[model samples]
Target: MRWIEAWTKIQTLFIPGVAGLREVVQGTRTTHPSDQLQCPQDFPLLLPSLILHSVSYDRTLEEIKWKLHEGQAHNALNELCQVLQSRAYMLKFKDSFL
Candidate 1:
């Protein structure tokens, strides 16, 4: 359920048009009339910002997993705490925007 909610929010942010978020992220333009969704030009940083955030989260999780696999439970726990703190800060920041 949480995964579904997260994915839905991602889809909402990068609402796909005929051109798709991938094309916009790559700085490509499509000539199709239906290619315009949320006016990517108006929010040029949105897709890349989301992509970067997602990548950072994934990398952090992978590092934590690797640490655990190596029996470095203490380091993994510390990293997890830091990630939670970062997430809390982000949530507060997002709420400020709202």
Candidate 2:
């Protein structure tokens, strides 16, 4: 259930950027404006690909390629979400100094 909450939070984090999101939900374009957005330098590249793979294993390679093209946007948000979920699982000690 915590994971569901975490995922919900992740979704909310992205709620404000529906301009690019609208294009996706409406299936009007294969490409998105957020595709041009930049991934944070501190974020690892492999993480997003892994998240994308896990969440959408059935997706075609072309679709994955489109989703991860510029290493930004929803891909990054999804990656960060998986990371957050993992950390939340360790909530008992997430802030412990020991």
Candidate 3:
């Protein structure tokens, strides 16, 4: 199997409820070993929503590729620098429009 495919099969343990866990295909399911996952710092937020959010089969691999190559969240934080700066200015000046 390919490296990515092999990596994909392994699930992570997430204690959902009292003694009731599920083996979900994605988004942090219960795994026998912890080493199976190599998650980033934002893993806590990403894991819960990986499967909950949808990407077409054709695009899933592409999205994964971008995730691996890009810094984080499709580089959303970087992309929104202007917006963040504007918000920061407004908040500093107590602008009501903000």
Candidate 4:
């Protein structure tokens, strides 16, 4: 499915750096000398970008929390399953090339 493909791409391209950033921000991880050479510590623009991303992540999480509170989690999951099944059916139909 397209959504799954997109999620996989994000996991491959974006997740590792974010995880590293999180560790750096939390003071739990340090970059090796060679790693610093690749993404120098003195990069002036990095802080603002990291802050923006952190805020965006926080806002998204808050929205999901409220949405879950408004709807029963089980109902939300059932709706998701229905959507995925419908999309799968459409994909299969298209693949049939009729």
TM-score of decoy 1 = 0.27
Q: What is the C-alpha lDDT profile of model 4 across 38-97, one tens digit per residue?
A: 333433222323455553343554566578777887788899999999999999999997
On the 0 to 100 scale, the lDDT of residue 67 in model 4 is 85
lDDT of 2 by residue, 1-98 (tens): 45544654564453334233434543543257755424444222222344453333334645666767766787788999999988887885766744
Encode model 3's per-residue lDDT on 1-98: one tens digit a residue. Answer: 34444333333223122112222333354345664546543222323235444322234545776677787765787779978998888898886654
Instruction: Candidate 2: list runs displaced more than 4 Å.
Output: 1-71, 92-98
Using all chains and alpha carbons, the TM-scores for the candidates as numbered come to 0.27, 0.23, 0.22, 0.28
Q: Given candidate 2, what's the lDDT at residue 11?
A: 42
Off by over 4 Å in 4: 1-71
State model 3's lDDT: 0.46
Taking the candidates one at a time, how many backbone clashes does each contain? 0, 0, 1, 0
Best by TM-score: 4
lDDT (CA) per prediction: 0.55, 0.50, 0.46, 0.54
Ordering by lDDT: 1, 4, 2, 3
Model 4 TM-score (2 dp): 0.28
Q: What CA root-mean-square deviation does each model show from the true structure?
A: 17.5, 18.7, 14.3, 13.4
> Which candidate number maximizes lDDT?
1
Give every collision pair in model 2.
none
